[model samples]
Target: MDERLKTNLNLWNAMVPVHVDSKGYRVDKFRSGENHLFPIEREEVGDVRGKSLLHLQCHFGMDTMSWARLGANVTGLDFSEKAIEAACALSAELKIPARFLCSNIYDAPNVLSEKFDVVFTSYGALCWLPDLKKWGAVAAHFVKPGGIFYIAEFHPMTQVMANGGGVAHAGEAKKLELEYSYFSTAMREFPPGPDYSDHSVTLEHGSHEWMYTTAGVVSALLDAGLQIEMLHEHPVCCFQMFPFMVRIEGTRYWRIEGDPIPLTLSIKARKPL
Candidate 1:
């Protein structure tokens, strides 16, 4: 593994225990038979019953086991060994049939040879990858012919906004300030800060991430020979991305006041038979 990825691996390994205990992951609820997946993904990738599903970049297999709960034969692959260990333990304890593998996304082809009926990845997974072309190829490689490849991810537009760092937040009417370029092809380094799942706990290790525009992401899948089925832009996000964002009435999603821009996107693609 590259030095940057190794650094990220260590960071993620540290996050597993924190996330398992965090309210954001709701591990206890999950153990008591709650599905962690949001309605958007469940509705978009409908009826996983009796299908083979492969979840890439699956941190501790919460979503992966959720699919298993829905009757999909599920396999989750992550780079962090700690996460995989936790996932296996959870699967055994809950009696949810699942296979968890530990391997970086780029090297997944060597670790797993079988193809899946659905290749799925979502939320906060894309930024960790430095190369989308290779990521696309790996996704394509895992999907059987005519199978589906789906992703529900944070929009690239959201990454450009200033989260903190001296930016003013004017209640509900806060203006979005651009902190990073959407077109730049550079790796970003973040300093040690609060964990996204639990703001009370701080992460000691900083990590590197890469950004990809919607166009860049779409192009990679097209180049990998997958046919684009649909690309949907959503005005709401699964979490509070900005300080001024408001949560919707009965949902786990948050939205900017007046809904000025897209906060998340989901794409459905199919491999050629």
Candidate 2:
């Protein structure tokens, strides 16, 4: 693996414990049989009952287990061993049968050789990847012919906004400001700091993340031989993506309230029979 990817892996390993305890991830609720899937994903990838599913970059496997709860035979893969361990423990404890593997998305094909009925990944996943084309190929490789591939992700446009820097300034910094570019041709480096699920703890390593245009993501899937089915954009996101986002009461979602920009995007593609 590249030095940058190794750095990201270490950072993720450091975050596993924090996420297990973070309220945002709702580890407690999930343990009580709450489904962690969002409405966008649930609606977009409907009816997982009796299908085999593969989730890429599944952090600790809450979402993967959620699919199992919905009756999909599920396998989740991540690069963080700590996360995979937690996922396994959770699956064993909850009696939700799932297979969790610790492998980088790029190396997934070499480690596993089963094509699934559904290839699924969601929110905050794509940014961690350095290569979308390879990511697309890996996704395609896991989908059986006539099966589906789906992703619900933070829109690339929203990724350009800056999350306010410090806790003291975060509440007051609720304005939409572009700190990065959407079409940047280079990977951006970030300093080590708090994980998003729990901002209280700092990471031991920083990460390198790439930016992609919607066209770039779509083109990669096309190049990977998947036929595009649908692309959907929404005004709200599952997390507080920007400081300006307001939590809509009684829902597990946040929005910029009339910002008129796509905060989230979902795409469904299929492998031809």
Candidate 3:
């Protein structure tokens, strides 16, 4: 692993327990049969019953096990060993039959040989990967011929604005101020701190992340021989990505009330038979 990735792995390992206990992850509700998946993903990746599903960067396997609950044979993979162990424990305790793997996404092919009917990942996943082309190939590789790969993630544009820029803190007007580039040549590195899931835990190591343009992500998948099926951008995100955003009443969606920009993006691509 690259040194940066190792540091990220350590950060993620530290996050497992914190995330498991966090109310946002809904570990308790998940145990009570609530699916952790958002509506966009559930609807876009529709009816996974009886399908073989592979979830990459599946933190603690909540979504992976949710797919299993819907009748898909599921396998969840993450670079964090602690996360995978926790996932395995959850699977056993709930009797939700699912497989969990502790391997970096790039090395996944070397550890697991099976292709699946669906290859899935979501939310905060792509940024952790330093190389989008390699990540694309890994995604395309696991998707069986004719199978689909799906992702619902924060928009790249949002990342550009969200990267220490344009954030309206609490009690301030929500407005976008572009502080980061849409096409930067370098990866952004930051001192490790509280992550989105849990704010209580802090890490000792620095973190690394890369932002990808919408075109860049789409092109990589195309180059990997996956046909783009659907690409959708939504104005509301599943979480309050911006500090000043508010959750829409009676919905799991959040947005800056009057200031709307694309906050989330979803794509579905299919491998040809």
Candidate 4:
């Protein structure tokens, strides 16, 4: 693994236990038969009953097992050994019948040769990848002919704005600022900070991330020969991306007060039959 990816792997490995115990992941609720998946992905991916599905960057397999709950033969892959171990343990405990693999996404082809009926990945997944072209190819490689390739991810547009940008906080509103360039290919490093799932816990490891445009992501899949089906921009996101965002009642999703901008993007593409 590249040094940057290795660094990220360490960070993710540390995050596994934190996230598993965090309320955000809802591991307890999942144990009680609640589906951890958001409506956007469940609706878009549709029925997976009896289909083989591969989930990339699957952290501890909550979402992957959620698919298995819906009757998909699910397999999850992540680079973090701790994460894979947690996922396997959870699957065994629940008797969910899942296969969890520990390997970098780019190296998936070498370790696993089976094609699937669906290739799935979601939220906060793309930013971890340093190269979209190779990532797209890897995703396409596992997708059988006529199989679906689906992603519901954070919109790149949201990445340009500063965190809490343009959102009201403590009776004050701030205009959104472009804190990061939208088109830069440079790798960005982040210092250790509050874990996303558990804000009370500070991560011991820093990590690296990359920025990608919507066009760049779509083009990558197109270049890999997946036919574009539909791309949907959503005003609501699975988590609170901005500090001032409000959570939708009865759902895990959050959104800006007036829903001014797209927070999530979902795409469904298919390999040629």
| Ordered list by lDDT, greatest first | 1, 4, 2, 3
Q: What do the candidate models score in CA lDDT, each in turn?
A: 0.90, 0.88, 0.87, 0.90
Q: Is candidate 1 or candidate 3 better by lDDT?
A: 1
Better of 2 and 3 by lDDT: 2
Residue 203, candidate 4: Cα error in Å is: 1.2
- Candidate 1: which pairs clash? none
- How does residue 55 of candidate 1 score in lDDT? 99
- How well is each residue in 1-273 modelled by candidate 4, as lDDT tens digits? 899999999999999999999987889999999999999999999999999999999989999999999999999999999999999999999999999999999999999999999999999899999999999999999999999999999999888877632222112434345778888889988888778878778889999989889999999999999999989999998876677778899888898888888899999999999
lDDT of 1 at 230: 89
RMSD over all Cα atoms, model 4: 2.4
- Model 1 residue 168 lDDT score: 24
Please identify model 3 stretches exceeding 4 Å from their true place: 162-173
Q: TM-score per candidate, in order?
A: 0.96, 0.96, 0.94, 0.96
